[model samples]
Target: MSVEVVIPNATPGTGEGPHWDDSTRSLVFVDITQKNVFRWDSVTGSLQKVHLEDEVGCVVPCKKGGFLVAVGRTIFHLEWSSQKLTKLHEIPLKGVGNRFNDGKCDPAGRFWIGTMGKVLSFEPLTFDMEKGELYCLDVDGSFHKRLDKMTICNGLAWSSDHKTMYFIESIPGQIMAFDYDVTSGNICNRRTVVNFGEFDPTDPENLGIPDGMTIDTNDNIWVAFYGTGQVICFNPQTGKMLRKIEIPCKRTTSCCFGGENLDELYVTTAQAGSTEEEREAFPASGSVFRVTGLGVKGHPANVFNGNF
Candidate 1:
């Protein structure tokens, strides 16, 4: 089977952390290197951009209103109306080369954001892989450290049943699952669900590590490969590869679901470190993709319950 994807907006650098806003019927994403946030309306086919002072890794809608955005080491409640970012709380992982990365709100409305160390560089690919940490912003405005020593904290998703939570530490090249407590917003008993070691990086069939992911109605996991130019699906419960959807870009980064029926799978990619030859090969890199008719629907994104 073949799935056709549409590029709604083109970006300049690394485009990561895609989110679907059910309320506005649009898709939101960030260009980390460009330090810009974008919102693309599904119906109007229009794109809106917002600039920040520093790198913006992720942006998720808040329950009360506006967006909860992770900018460097601090998280803010960004209001589009006034173009303002109201300070919520800042993570203390600063000064150690740590910055916020991919994040999302859990089923219980708690915000779970992860961080990565600036010491790492993908161009030459060198750094301490164990310097980052993942934190949970409680509904009561308190920060709780959950996991530590992460290199690049990426993809985050909760099972439809809310019993399992999936997290990715990008550098390790593996996806981990944990026993999720939806009511308490806790993740424990971590175990590897998907390991990239099984896939050879030199082979085009298995290009690069998984960067970001999304879940379907049937609980299958669809992950975007960083340098692979494809979004592959797997049965997370069984660790079996299900399907691979080739993309027009080389550095596929993240994905989510949007549209009225929530059947459209939106994918994001990166083009920042590409050489001229590489750019000529995959000109569509760093573009937001929209793929439909995958025969699976994804859950609507959860909103942050924390105050702005």
Candidate 2:
């Protein structure tokens, strides 16, 4: 019943992927458009941003120190101290106008990532339902393309038991579930888990867009609705929405649980849809936020250490 938006004022245009760092008890996220990575400590209310020359789409802490960054069309291992970027792999399809989008590490320590067609140009949407493949880079340095033909591969989460996987495709607004085999880190039996209704172009509130998501300790799924200004919670098994957290910003991009005890929910918002006047009115449009409640703590993702 009680909700408050922390960090309501922050820099705008932040398309971020959040990572929970247990070592420092801080929540890390990036402003992809701004080319900056931030570490927020809930205990001291400290926020630190590291400037980078290139756009860093996602950041996952590396087990050996530094971070594995998913930049525009390639994945790299970054050494934060020296500002060095080492290219790891180039996603296979460059001609299709598809580029890496959302990514996360599976429980098996393999990184799962998806690509989307560039929306700026007239190029047909690169989603090949057969080509928009999900990929995994094992600790052994071998790469595997898991699934494909996905348009804007977004939300990715694994159940606590590591037997189920949840994924989302942004355009059509569908959340899918897969039966995951832990032994081989393979997924199958893909099925629709949830679907949002269409929005009336005349009414703003009814439009629900799919974005990033995080799973709670109790298996509840919290998804950020890109254009809806809200985060909806759902029971994964029943596909029922249990609650919604209202956000003031129109483009709520992503969320994750991070804190000393992992009880606080940190959210990232964007100024992607702001008009010139609206942009000036809300300068910190692309800032991070925090909220409490929902009784959930996220499982920190494991970084690849080059060991199979």
Candidate 3:
């Protein structure tokens, strides 16, 4: 596999939640701390950025038109061409400290998103644990609470058959699997698919916490490790590591499959709380990266079926 820096220093803060828009042939992602949503056109090699008033967590295309965006604790419908944002629904949190994080649309077109506790500090990497929750937004604009008491909820993906859902809880360093009902958009039978145990976010020698993830046509899970400069592939069924791709930046936040044939992997990194030494060591810290020649393809991202 070959890794290339597509956009050098794409964001000044954390870059998370990447989705490939097959209809537009572009890569959509968000810079959380910077409160910016970006779209990079693959064919034209041009970038379009939309700055929002709140911290943007994720962005997904809509089947009917426009786009669905998670900003702060609310979901909004964004008319990209006009740069208009209309609020859809806001999730009620126990405290104001919680906010939306990584999210994506399921095969059935329901938005699955999770929240994280108050960020205490980035330099020392501290946060309030077990204060977050996961919610599912349906096509009818109704919200359903899935799980609660989560710590640093992040990456989410479903199996090729849409029967198994994979979720990442970063602080506990676990990849959870749940039996899913595609039609009803319900998930149950929760179990641990991959457990890295609890990790210390402050320790540079740690194995790294799982952040954002995506699955390939063969059902292999590609997970981006936060503290480690690596994106590891795993066989979810066997819970075994298959391959590993080294990234230039240590704080690799998220990744997705893009390209015309969906054979390329796009990764996003962060430079928000990096020290001077780290910035010098990894010059492409906040850049967007593209990995090609992996010999595997992924399914096109699902768009929200709701007609706002």
Candidate 4:
């Protein structure tokens, strides 16, 4: 597959959470460490960025206009034109050293987001054992907890029928499936759907760290694996990997479907945590990439309901 660089330097650190805003016909994403939220127009080839004070985890477009931004435990309402930010709701973690990570809007218009622990130790190689929690911001502006005890909550997707929800926790090395209720936006009957246990464990480069994912019309989950340098397509129902598209960068962060027909897959990558040699080997480490000719389209991103 021929990969094209959409943004030469998307971010300095942690380029993640790409969301396609159908309203504005632009692709929006964030650079966590840089505290930058970016928007791009593929047709016009224009790029715009908004700088926030804290680490920006993700940005999703709201139906009522503007955007819902998850940054440092607080989700804010952002007006890209005026560069104004208003506090929407905060994800509570108490004394735990955790912050929000990857998230998206459910089909019912509720904003579903999750968090990760901040503290990490290399002596014995440990991250915050505080656990990851998934939270949903309801249409009436109330926040509720949905899932718990995950590490580095990452990608999210729902089936075309809206009866299934696919989620990932970076450390678990798998994509989990849950019975989803579209009306109430609830999930239950959790089970492993696409565990990467089959991947070669001896290779450090292929550690199956599932990061971000999107679903196709045929119910195929295309997931980006961090440290693996590839995005893979898996059939959750069949428990099999259908295909893998290799990437140039080592840290493949997240991906979303967009473009005119929604067939173009936009992928984000990071260079922040890579070794010097790895960064040197892949010069376009932090760039945004685009892949086409997959012959499958993804669902339109759900718009956030900011009515509350």
Candidate 5:
């Protein structure tokens, strides 16, 4: 396998979500703190970006048209061509400082998104804990709360069979599995599939916090470790590490499979809150990378089927 920089210094802040747009044959991602949405076309080798008014957690293509985006506490429909945004739904977080974080669409076309306590600061990083919740926005413009009391809700993915849903909660450093009903968009039977707490904290390899994730065709969970500079593949059934791909930067935020065959792994990193020593160690900290020859393909990204 080979790894190379695709977009060097993509963002100064955190580059969180990475989604492959099959229709456009491009990769779509977001820079949370920067409030920017970006699209990089594979065919033309061109990049497009749009700055939003609020922090953007994730962006997914809509089945009908345009794109579905999670911005701050609200969901918006973005017309990329004209840069028009229409507010869809907003979570009612009265006095709580919570905003949407990482999210994606399930196979059945429901937009599943989660929120985290508002980021107080990046440098010397600080945020409230256990103030997040997960919700599913159905096709008919209905919303359902799936889970709550989450701290830093991050990566989300579904099993190939669509019976299991996987999620990541960064603070506890655990990957959770849920029994999923694709027909009803319900998730239950929550259990831990992988726990970083089981590893020795003193070990350098174990220092990374679990962050964004994706799954291969075989249903193996590939998770990006925030501080470890590695993306590790784990067998969900056995909860065992299968392989580890090292990144050039420490704050490896998220990854997704792109390319025409979905064989290339596109990774996103962050340079926000980096110290001088770390900046020198990883000069390309905020770049997006593409890994080829992994010998595994991913399922095409699911688009939101919502009418709005």
Candidate 6:
């Protein structure tokens, strides 16, 4: 089946991060280029926008009627009522190019977030400023250690059993897995789970880098390709690409399993850095899309406890 772009011409430039909020039964996404947070309900057909001062990276649901949000450099605990946000906690960062990119909470309600370098006008994509790192913050006001040296980190996900952790280093086209100790929140045994280069010999550079990811019940990982026009599904065990859901957009930013049965695949796309002539090529560039009959029921979203 083909994936349909729901919000046609929704965002202007970079419409990046998306998170499915089960509590409100709607999808929350952000336009990094516009610095706007949007909540769109498929059931009621209502769309709302919360304009923020700084660029927003990721937004996950919280336990006590709030959300955990990552702005440019700090992670904040926010309470949203009447579409207004109140700050709770702020986690600081060190790198200039570094900003929070992709994130999600594990089974235990700990938010796992990654940082990436800024796209400078002059510099090409290279490992700069210890660009990416993984961090964990528990619900008990406990701060865990950070994973170091990864550049352009994206696509954070966990296996069905929560024993395996999967992540992607976007530009280099590397997908890695770690032996996750859930109890201690420590990751070990870093090994390559999926490498994108070997899969496609033709036009690897322009095919796009991996962005946001989600896990199916069978432990399959669905990754949105940044420059490529497809969402690739990989078997976690073998790192083999089983399916590719082709989208008609240039920049497929992120995807998640939504809908009542959690079978519908909701995807977010971007028109971030496109030129005038290039924009004419893809009209629905920065839009949200959905596909059904995937047969994967995703886990409900984790809510961050207000006290955390």
Best by TM-score: 3
The positional error of residue 142 in candidate 2, measured at the CA in angstroms, is 1.6
Candidate 3 local lDDT, 1-308, one digit each (tens) = 79999988988799888899988899999999999999999999999999999998899899988888888889899999899998888877655478999899999898888998878887677788898889998988888889999988899998999999999999888999999999999888999999998667667666697999999999999999987778999999999999999999989998999999999999999988889999999999989999999999999999899757
For 1-308, candidate 5 gives per-residue lDDT tens digits of 99999999988888989999988899999999899999999898898999999989999999999999999999999999999999988987733588999999999999999999976765545578788999999989898888888878899999999999999998778999999999999888999988886334358658488889999999998999987789999999999999999999989999999898999999999988788899899999999999999999999999999788
In model 5, what lDDT does residue 190 have? Answer: 93
lDDT of 6 by residue, 1-308 (tens): 75787777677767766777876789988887688778898889888887777778888887776677778867776655555565544546566656777888887778888877766642123445557777777777676646777777788888877798898887678889999877767889999887765224256555567888988888888999876678989997887889889888867888888888788888888887766765788788888999887767777755565354
> What would the TM-score be for candidate 5 when compared with the true structure?
0.96
Question: Tens digits of per-residue lDDT for model 1 on 1-308?
Answer: 44454653367788998899998888889999899988888789788889998888899988888898889888988898687988877777554567888998998899999988884555655555577888999888888999987788889988999999998877868989999999888788999998886445567656487889889889988898887788888899999999888888878999998889998888898888878898888777777878877888999888898654
lDDT of 4 by residue, 27-123 (tens): 9999998999999987688999999998888999988888999889898999989999888777666445688889999889988998887737422
**Per-residue lDDT of 94 in model 2:** 52
True-vs-predicted CA distance for residue 255, candidate 6, Å:
0.4
The local distance difference test score of model 6 is 0.76
Each prediction's TM-score against the native? 0.94, 0.88, 0.97, 0.94, 0.96, 0.91
Error of 6 at 301 (Å): 2.7
Tell me the number of clashing residue pairs for each predicted model: 0, 11, 0, 0, 0, 4
Off by over 4 Å in 4: 94-96, 119-126, 197-207
Model 6 weakest lDDT span, ten residues long: 121-130
| Pick by lDDT: 3 or 4, better one | 3
User: How well does candidate 4 score on lDDT at residue 103?
Assistant: 90
Q: Give residue 15's lDDT in candidate 2 (0 to 100).
A: 58
Candidates ranked by TM-score? 3, 5, 1, 4, 6, 2
Give the distance in Å from residue 76's predicted Cα in candidate 3 to where it truly belongs: 0.8
Off by over 4 Å in 5: 94-96, 121-125, 198-202
In model 6, state the lDDT of residue 38. Answer: 80
